[model samples]
Target: MSNDAVTPGETRFYQGEGQTQPLFRIEPGINCQFAREQASELMGYAQDLVLDGLLERKHNMIWAAHYLNALAKALLDDAELGLAKAKAL
Candidate 1:
């Protein structure tokens, strides 16, 4: 990992050993760090399922990812509101 944090508008590309194409796009946001972490974890889980050859269980993974995304969004919303509260205090 690089020491520099990813700024908004910048995209990070991943290249796997056997991948001829880009593996994924990573966009970092300072304000939504927690949300980004959660989303990444959820995506990792989904990828594991696919790699394990459990294609039939893909729907479950999708649902899990959806819920995790919602949770992350909620967390980001709270963090944004918390900043206001902190400033007021």
Candidate 2:
């Protein structure tokens, strides 16, 4: 799909032939921006959790670390996508 032609809130899905399963649409625009921002903020919280020795408390550390790593990867992917979009423009 052309980048500029993409609607800000349109939902697109992929499906295999003969499959009746529903497809999930990627969040667009402000919603996506908010989600990414929240992820980033959560990552910071995870760091704090680890730094404050909260890791030993009810396995919060493990959960925090996992989320931090996942968010980092996602953020990197988003950055790359953004860079590509900019270049495409």
Candidate 3:
């Protein structure tokens, strides 16, 4: 029930030259299996957000939905790249 071993010191992805934007943190491992599990979980959550926004017509939800969708895409891309790297090794 601990991830201290796999975890690293810095987890967040920082943007900008000044490091102003702290977008998100990476999942625990660089392995494909971990990537797939994390991606599937994120996709499910993002899809739910989008669906909830569409059904209820909440303006805030819509905004969140967009960001979540983009995050999911980024996560999937990372997962695919991780899978490729893992296969090559």
Candidate 4:
């Protein structure tokens, strides 16, 4: 946690990040597809916001999309490994 937010395509546990509940928790289970859908919805919202010229909140939506998709990927990766080493987000 170097005063920087967690970026997409990353799964680093900051010094104090794991002490609190994660903003988004993607479990390695049947809910993965739903997580993907939610990520897509976030992307759509980001796109729509940009189209409407709403610049302020668009980045939030886009960031949500990125991280949600990343979490979904992590979930699937854990499932692929037989869930033995799956972390609970």
> Candidate 1 — what's its lDDT?
0.47
User: Residue by residue across 7-51, what tens digits does model 4's lDDT show?
Assistant: 232232222344664454334333434444555665666456555
Query: In candidate 2, which residue ranges exceed 4 Å CA deviation?
Result: 1-26, 30-39, 53-58
Q: What is the TM-score of each candidate against the true structure?
A: 0.39, 0.44, 0.57, 0.34
At residue 60, candidate 1 shows an lDDT of 70
Specify the highest-lDDT model's number: 3
Least accurate stretch of 10 residues (summed lDDT) in model 2? 1-10
Model 3, 1-89: lDDT tens per residue?
12112322134555457887778865645554554566677777777877888899877877776666665555556656555544555
Two-way TM-score contest, 3 vs 4, winner:
3
Model 4 misplaced regions, further than 4 Å: 1-57, 83-89
To one decimal, what is the Cα RMSD in angstroms of model 4 from the true structure? 11.3
**Whole-model Cα lDDT of every candidate shown, in order:** 0.47, 0.52, 0.59, 0.43
Q: List the residue pairs that clash in candidate 4.
A: none
Kindly indicate the candidate among 1 and 4 with the higher TM-score: 1
**Lowest-scoring 10 consecutive residues by lDDT in candidate 4?**
1-10
Candidate 2 RMSD to the correct structure: 7.8
